[model samples]
Target chain A: MVLEATNNVLRLDANFVDYTLVAIYFVFVIGIGLLARRQVSTSLDFFLSGRSLPAWVTGLAFISANLGAVEIMGMSANGAQIGMATMHYYWIGAIPAMLFLGVVMMPFYYGSKVRSVPEFMRRRFGTGAHLVNALSFALAQLLIAGVNLYLLATIVNVLLGWPLWVSLIAAAAVVVTYTALGGLSAAIYNEVLQFFVIVAALLPLTLVGLHRVGGIDGLVDKVNNGPVENMLSSWPGQNLTGFESPAASVIGIVLGLGFVLSFGYWTTNFVEVQRAMASNSMSAARRAPIIGSFPKMFIPFIIIIPGIIASVLAPEILALNEGKGDGNIQYNDALLILIRDLLPNGMLGVAIAGLMAAFMAGMAANISAFNTVFSYDLWQQYVKKDRPDGYYTRVGRIATIAATIIAIFTALLASGYSNLMDYLQTLFGFFNAPLFATFILGMFWKRMTATAGWAGLASGTIAAIGVAVLSQDALGPLSVGAIDLKGQGASFVAAGAAFFVDIVVSVIVTMFTQPRVESELKGLVYSLTPKEDRTDPNEKNLPWYQRPVLLAGISLVMVIILNIVFH
Target chain B: MADTDKQAAKEKRAIRAFDIRTIIGALLGIYGVILVLMGIFASDSDLKGGDGSSTNLFTGIVLLVVSAFFLTWVRLRPLLVPEGDDDAADAHIE
Candidate 1:
């Protein structure tokens, strides 16, 4: 049944005109990268754009890099299946994360002048923490890169009638070549162009799609009348997949996402930190987050709303649609379905461009970050310590190519995985959540000694991995009910468990361990609150935690009002 | 450092002024506040959920007020040019 439906839908024919245009766009992106090659003479330039990016450019590029093909489908699929609650991840989860990051952590990061998040980890903790962070981050990058490639290939295959591997190779080649040629500068420049194209295509389609589905009012009615409506409205109902129960969702929304996720990703993630590293000044870096937060406020209206409308637009397919046995929608096909059925002639080409833009941007960012880690953190730190800057630049470009090849193969494997968002969250649970806990403790807690940092990381990792392994039936045949909630419950589990374990371990270890030397603490603490160094060098200071506190409060009020009302 | 060096630094301040980037950023914050307001008032008529009642009005008012804080701050903050080389900024406390 699924195959037949796929066969019927996959009959989309891309002629010479469509292929020619896509090919031209690909060439243009590559050309831009090659043109930017002159700017990328040193390793620093290649990896961090020579720190010349202004506020708007960095802000736009930051959002564009994260809004790739995988995120698009994952968000849309969530909106389609889960109802309005999917909106919480962005409104309640991501927005607060961005603001707190801007207010609390940016000063430290911008002030310290660290090349990467893991490099900062090294200065604070030790070589050991740096290596573990570098490795785990690399692994997370691999997963995201692979999924991004799969999304690109899947979209092209479904929409253009190309073979999956053919689409994968073609798409990967263009991004890899450009990224290898120009590095971070090329990636940022291309992201700006791609961001425009993505917004142009998506905004129109969202409006038209909503209009076709009876506008926002009609969409609300259809969803409210649908089977998934109740699940979609509030979280952790029968159809609710993530965020545990309503109580947990409320608390998690308030505490976890409001504080932890915002601070963690914005402040510590290598990819995000890399963006800020390219800023022209501390002020530019500060503006990056504030400017970046603006796009996210409007994105859900275009991205997720279309999914809700899609459910109404194609009620026939959704209702009678026999998805995979596990209940995963062929989510990669959702946007393609919308494009083929709804859009007019020229617009189809535009939507195709938009999807390609998203795919390429994501793939390029992942490969670039992966290469950066391999070159700077791992290679420079451990392998060959004294290479020339130009040589490392060349090697970083080579790592770009290598990372793409690895992702291409892994993407093929990921084809068997179900749903983009769920897969992303599950992977984050095992990897990113632990990293988050360790980074937060490492930053905010003054008495959080090295032993505390390592213990927090170790406990978080073991607990998360244990849950993941146990959920996977690794401990023998469990009752169906025992593992039934693993799909949606895993993220909340990992997030809560990692936080608690890291806190416990950090506190317990800190009791017996000494704080970091005063000199060592100077970089992080002084950076956070500039006045601290002058006020009293010996007195441990917490930066105006009040700013993040205020910002977080504002963010919460915004999310509550937006989600309950607009979403 | 001599008086000459200080004089040189003072003369090199290249038009310390707010520009298009600042305006654009500040405007974007205003737009975010507008969106929150739209969400609140429109919620009653909006399909998503929530009763169109006094509670929503109250929630909406509170959110608009909070968003106003960000909006006002973005507009009010002074533009500060970098004090040295871009790469030097990276070595601020290193």
Candidate 2:
């Protein structure tokens, strides 16, 4: 295979047809956004799609919104480096948390009628807790949006030889225009479209790559013969060092990713939950995440397998340099290299369209969540109260534009980071770890006081920052030990530590403080809410296979089988 | 009797045939069909890029089938207007 090298920079041989196909994708996405404009008459419609979307639409969009450029590029990079252990992000990290959101938390969110996740915090805890959580969430969304934009621009610049600035500006303009006009309905609809585009784009690449490398067995043999060994194993030991970090033991993966980070993101992060909240009914809302879990189980085959194939096909490009300068193969370019080397012109255009769609869907998801939190949680609540529905709707539109502009600058700043996924998860550790602790204490325990809630949130966040600082070797005086805990392992350790600290602080404070009255606690806490209110009214009417429990059970069984086979 | 009339009007307004699913299904089917055609008629040069294979053609078929399934699902169980405004109340919470 001949790889095009121009000035030592590898570029995909994209022609006029490829560029035309990509342009068509942009027009189609923006058109969908404008088409949905008719549906956005009220603030509720703008932010939550009038709460009328079905389970399938919401479910697909739920997973699609999370499948950003970072996920496609970053996970494949991990797959190349660590092999099958990358599946943990899907199976252990994502599936359980998604199920918990559907089965346990959706009732409180949908039943109580909170517009956003921070509002849930306010209703459960008090203003101080709400503001802290809301501000952190809003900031995190912007940063994450910036990261997505940065990754997309970098990949485009490398593949198409377009200037990074042009890519960033064009992407921002398309996403902001559609998002501002269409609202959440437009975002969700486009996400479903983007989901199909991504799958269509990547599945072909995987098939072609596998065929070139030989079939599944050929892939296995090629990968084993390459520099990396045990590329097919899911377990930590046995030559598979779990996500390229020695510190990422089985326990660390379980607690950090599976419990704290995953639960924090899937359950409380407004970006994902906003999709479920837009469902037509409480039953649909509960089922949305559950339905999403079905596709979430099999996504690794398309995404991760390409990276593994690249490890064997282009080891020179996949190689890393210890120095801070240029490496033999930039790890993040795994997906791009596969496309450049493998796909034909017509098919290449389709893959590029899929890549762009994934980037736009991710940016739109973050921007949508940012606008909702800013308008409802921050602006309407504090900046101006009791505004007309149209007023908040206007604010949401303005917020989308503002957030996009801010994200552009943030993306520019994010160019300094070497690994996109590591930067993202570390940020998640800073906010999500402590945030999940607060949510857990408030949800299951009725006696948990507002004072305790704020304390746990504040202290838990502080603990995470402290652990991160101490884990750094450069900060010698601040370093706790010589152990250099990095990657997901460091984030997991910080989150696990914060989880316990938040629990301890919350428990002690709740014991000393007065609990809210029964009336105040109704529908908010598990113990106080009636059993009938908690149960889905349509559960008994549906067939056995259609129920959330059975769906979750089947998904878990499949995950278990994959783990066993891969292990 | 006036309340009943008002309720009837609201229900009538809510009973529209078009929904998000219809839009998703139709758009995906259109795009998938176009892609499949392009893949099948790809030039010799294009075929060289993919090693004389039809990966795009197969993937496009899969997308087309999935899109049809979504459309069929909507036809089987169409959305109806709920009797009361539970969502409206939830949406307005301070």
**Residue ranges of candidate 1 with Cα displaced over 4 Å:** A1-8, A11-21, A231-245, A252-263, A320-332, A416-428, A469-484, A526-529, A532-560, B1-94
Measured by DockQ, the strongest candidate is 2
Candidate 1: count of backbone clashes, pairs at least 3 residues apart or interchain = 1
How accurately is candidate 1 docked according to DockQ?
0.05
Candidate 2 stretches greater than 4 Å from native: A1-8, A237-248, A321-328, A416-425, A473-484, B1-18, B71-86
iRMS of every model, one decimal? 12.6, 4.1
- What DockQ would you assign to candidate 2? 0.35
lDDT of 2 by residue, A1-567 (tens): 011223236577887767877777787788788777866666887999878887888999999999997788878888877788889888888999999888889999888788899999999998989998888889888988887887777667767887888988988899999999989988998898888778777888898889888898898887777666666777773233224554458778778778987888889889999999998877888889999998988898999999888887764444541123244466667788788788877568778888888988899999999999999999988889976567999999999999999999988777654344344546555777878888877989998999999999888877877777667421233546545665456667778888888889999999999987877877789989887776678778988766777777787788788778877
Of all true interface contacts, what fraction is found in model 1? 0.05
Look at candidate 2 and tell me the lDDT of residue A302. 91
Q: Against the native chain B, what TM-score does each candidate's chain B reach?
A: 0.34, 0.70
lDDT of 2 by residue, B1-94 (tens): 1355345434643654456666667766766776677677876566655464366567667778888987998899787755545445345754
